[model samples]
Target: MNLFHFSEENGIEVFVPRVKENRKNMPPVVWAIDDVHAFTFYFPRDCPRIVYTRTNEMSDEDHEKFFGLTSSDIIVTVETDWYERIKRTTLYRYKMPSDTFQLFDACAGYYISPQTIIPQEVEPLTDLLNRLMLLNIEVRFTPNLHPLRNAILNSTINDFGMHRFANAKGN
Candidate 1:
């Protein structure tokens, strides 16, 4: 394991020179709020709508069929609450107008809120989820091991449990 980790780290270091050269000389637009929160680079708020990617389990075909873009379209530029301490990162994506979908400049959002944040944030999931590390509420992932232990009975919920477990895995 030590040898493997050492080789991996060495390989990453070897790539650092190329990575630095490839990096664009751009100013940092995103601003960090406290230690956990941050905001996007100051750009025209009225510009083209930004795209967001769908969930991991969502296939490329299904995402394009439903939302017209793969999961990579979404960009998460900020997070502002204690949830960061819990390793729960929140992401956001903006959607544009096109066939099948009617809304223009709509915000198609999602969040990785844990059980810890549910009791802390007061607003609805739609409103509170857009911003990260939302101090407005105390939240963390719920500890429900029963469903996880009995995962084989229901595959869909089991998948959800897996996702939730994945989010909390580091802790």
Candidate 2:
């Protein structure tokens, strides 16, 4: 399986394990996302995003409520303010070997490695919005994500990821 690490900065020769501020209790580790879910990270590092997919577990009511009239199975929402930055940002996709990494969250396609890693290759990705569109991902711009975040939390949409929410507006 192909594993990747996305970053706004380039020239990353090695990845070292480090504890995240919010995940202090967990052991230090290098995080990577599998190819299947890599599209979710195609944005500025701190840009807040909420991604959800239509799953079998979703009820008819919830489906219509969240995805009414939309044919796309995956939806990615970001704050309107970040649109300009996203258009200008270029992300470096670092290909990492899978030998030292283990699945961290299957649903999120997240993997973790305790050992330091040197990327096999680094590819720069531009035209972020177009890239997401090419993947058939529906991108929504909102003034605030709290409402949708709250609604999803209270709904049956389990296949979702809310990232960097603290950076979201009105957080």
Which lDDT tens digits does candidate 1 get at residues 1-171? 000001101112111111112224622211111111112211122211112233656655545553453223333221122223323322322211112122211222111211111111111112333342343322223343333234223322111112212222222
Measured with C-alpha atoms, the lDDT of residue 25 in candidate 1 is 62
Q: What TM-score quantifies how close candidate 1 is to the native fold?
A: 0.19
Instruction: Please give the distance, in angstroms, between residue 143's alpha carbon in candidate 2 and its true position after superposition.
Output: 0.5
Which stretches of model 2 miss by more than 4 angstroms?
Answer: none
For candidate 2, the lDDT comes to 0.96
Write model 2 residue lDDT over 63-148, tens digit each, in one string.
99999979999999999999999999999999999999999899999999999999999999999999999988999999999999
Highest lDDT: which candidate? 2
Cα deviation of 21, candidate 2, in Å? 1.3
* Local accuracy by lDDT, each model: 0.24, 0.96
**What TM-score should be assigned to candidate 2?**
0.98
Tell me, what's the RMSD of every candidate? Answer: 18.8, 0.8
